[model samples]
Target: MVISPPEKPTRDEKQSAGRNVAIVALFAALGGMLYGYDTGIISGALPKMSAQWGIDHTRQEIVTAAILAGAVIGALVGGSLSKRLGRRKTIFIIACVFAVGVVACALAVDAWMMTFCRLFLGLAVGACSQIVPTYIAELAPPQRRGAMVTFFNIAIGVGIFLANLVSVVAAAGDSPEASSNWRWMIGIAVFPALVLAAAMLQLPETPRWLIENGTVGKARVVLRWMRPNRTAAVEETLQIWAISQQEDKESRGGWANLTQRWARPALIAGLGIAAFTQLSGLEMMIYYSHTILGTAAGFDAGLVVWSGLGIAAVYLIFTAVGERLVDVVGRRRLMLTLIPGSTVFLFGFGLMFVLTDHPNRYLTLALMLAYMACNAAGLQAVGWLLGSELYPLSIRDRATSLHAVALWGSNLVLTLTALSTIDGLGLGPAFVMYAGFNLLSFVFVYFAVPETKGHSLEDIEQSLRDGTFLPLRGNIASRIGLPDNRITTGAAAD
Candidate 1:
């Protein structure tokens, strides 16, 4: 009998070899915390800033959205920069930028100056949002990739939760002096930003990025760092290198490459998924939650604080569930399940808003919570993950950058429009608009989006090129020509 050599350990097997990947993921996730803290802090801090600066609603919206606007630019620039400078380096730069922006925000003396500072901070937040998940995805083993990248969303929820909790505590004292504590709320981010920046010094650069840049030796070193004892580290590195070389040979990997015939559908799918995710009106609810709760639901400030906390908590929980289910049910299935659920919730919430004369505060709050739960369980958790997964590694950075810009740009517009829409059309009409957007999303996903669970990046690229919108599941190992048992028979098998 011929004896066969032992099978090589795949990336997924290496995931359990040590805690290095987890540690790296944790540090990278700090960038997400800053993204969340900065965005959500404005919700509570805006009212205080408006009083101090004596700005009108329009001006206040501008201040609140200045960071988002800056993020649009940051996402575009950061995506391209990460491709050149490497993911780890790009995120390090983002951390430093965040630290600077936080300090500037804390020290601003006037509304114009504060807006200026916010624009600066927005760039950091935008860059973090774009780069952190990509970095985590690139570094993570495919088996745990979804869970690892989901940390970004988790960090975001935590950031928002902490911001709200701090704001409530800071505003506890009943006096003029107590009201200005919002500044401190915004300033607290500086500590985390600084910590994130400092921690990046110890993390390894992404092995994939290294290989893409013709630094194979460096890539091997980094791979070893991630999987110290796995002999398959070098094999996986070579496989990735082969894929990158093939991509480069076929396409020059330029901006024009994304517009080529083979890449267009992937681009459209990425951008559409991202845009529809925002169109769900989640950011609008996030930015104006306090105002909406107080005005539409007739909840007081104390109730708004509690409600905000509840929203964050529920968001975190559902997002966790979504993360676990993403690899199991596949991206398309998750979208199919969650989009209709979100739409129904939004429609009912809209009707409730329209039907009741002086709607019951608790009932309205409950409906809003239901809407948030649906969003968190679906769009918020899956959107970024799907966007990151849909594109080939060749144009992944550019595609992700474009998608981030679209999402944040839509968020900027929605944030700016929320107060106006509420003032002009009332809460019911505003929700009705979101309900329509969600309905449209349901149609788009059902028709256009493909399932990507368990497919390798290379396999996904082939599927996109072949115009197969649905994933071909089962025996993916043989279909993709990967070794049987290379990946554990777990959620990936589903």
Candidate 2:
């Protein structure tokens, strides 16, 4: 059955398709923004909630950890929903949840009510973390995939930065009316939620997913919109069709597939990275910088709130930097370079706490910002990207579900125990413990993680089947026998 391939697309068609992909990716990345705002808002709102509700420290911890509990459940269930409903629909559902949950939180009358509302909101947060990167990765071309998927990460930083900025503004006045400002902080997320829901209604399903589901005709249409021309679109659609058929014949895609010997490396890398991302203590800083600074470090109230704003800015800036460098430097090398610096900065931050009850404010702030730059640019940037890209297509949805569970579960444990840990061990020892975790993360990456820069998703899958996924030989690209052009710009012309 020989057939002629379609002609290459015209220059105008290529430019148009590029614009379509970019627009879609940006709209979908709004899911990440909602995830960030909903989760990060709590840090600033919690103190106000405590002041208004007269909740004790134990109750305050419960309120903060509530959403985390729901996130675990959301991650657990997101796999089935994504597989059955499709990514676009699942995201729409997540958006609706975000909208409803935020409104409920804003209307809460007591601590328990707030906990219940945030718990409900966490479902969307957890699902957004799991699904948005995968959706973006599936939409983008191999060369641009790193940057596109990272748009979700960047949007998250945007949400967090906005949350902190709002908190700073809300905290400006000292009257009793200030206690009510938490409602505004929590409620503002509804607008973005509504916006995301509207956007998802217009975006196309990823061609890879359509091919997987045996709708080659529709997949070809989608590829046309995403790729440069008719020829490129048909070629990619055929490739995906071939891979999907082969996977169907050889494997049943589900939890059981995760246990196969060939899938073990990906499982180890994806799950390990997910856990390490949370255990790095970046979330602790995002969620509790004010507590760490004001209560533990003896900073004034204004400085504490403003320090949170500074922390958020550093995260947003470095995550943007990492987006540009991920493909150029390669993922494994970038992590290796930045993680050690994170270890050093965190260690220095802890040492100051140990040395003096009143550590110099500027020194502590400097160390925190430095730690943030290293952590955000490295582990934080790569964690979600790797999770979205690492697994074989057959098991991608289920694998990402498990990845989300590991991330949210680790986060839940950390947030639940952070205040108690600090109270019991003191801030110095607690931070030192986190620094040790960063060192351990470095060791894990060096031994097990492989560089995936400039490789196609199918290419990575083939490496797994061939038992050549590990970087045990040759230069980074040559380890996988990639062409030099792919190793560089991911374009044949390069």
Model 1, span 84-133: residue lDDT tens: 89888899899989988988898999889999999999888877888898
Clashes (N, CA, C under 3 Å) per candidate: 0, 0
Which predicted model would earn the best lDDT?
2
Q: Which run of 10 residues does model 1 get worst, by summed lDDT?
A: 482-491
Off by over 4 Å in 2: 1-11, 176-178, 250-253, 473-494
Q: What ranges in model 1 sit over 4 Å off? A: 1-4, 7-18, 176-178, 227-231, 250-253, 469-494
Query: What TM-score would each prediction reach against the true structure?
Result: 0.91, 0.94
lDDT of each: 0.79, 0.86
State the TM-score for model 1: 0.91
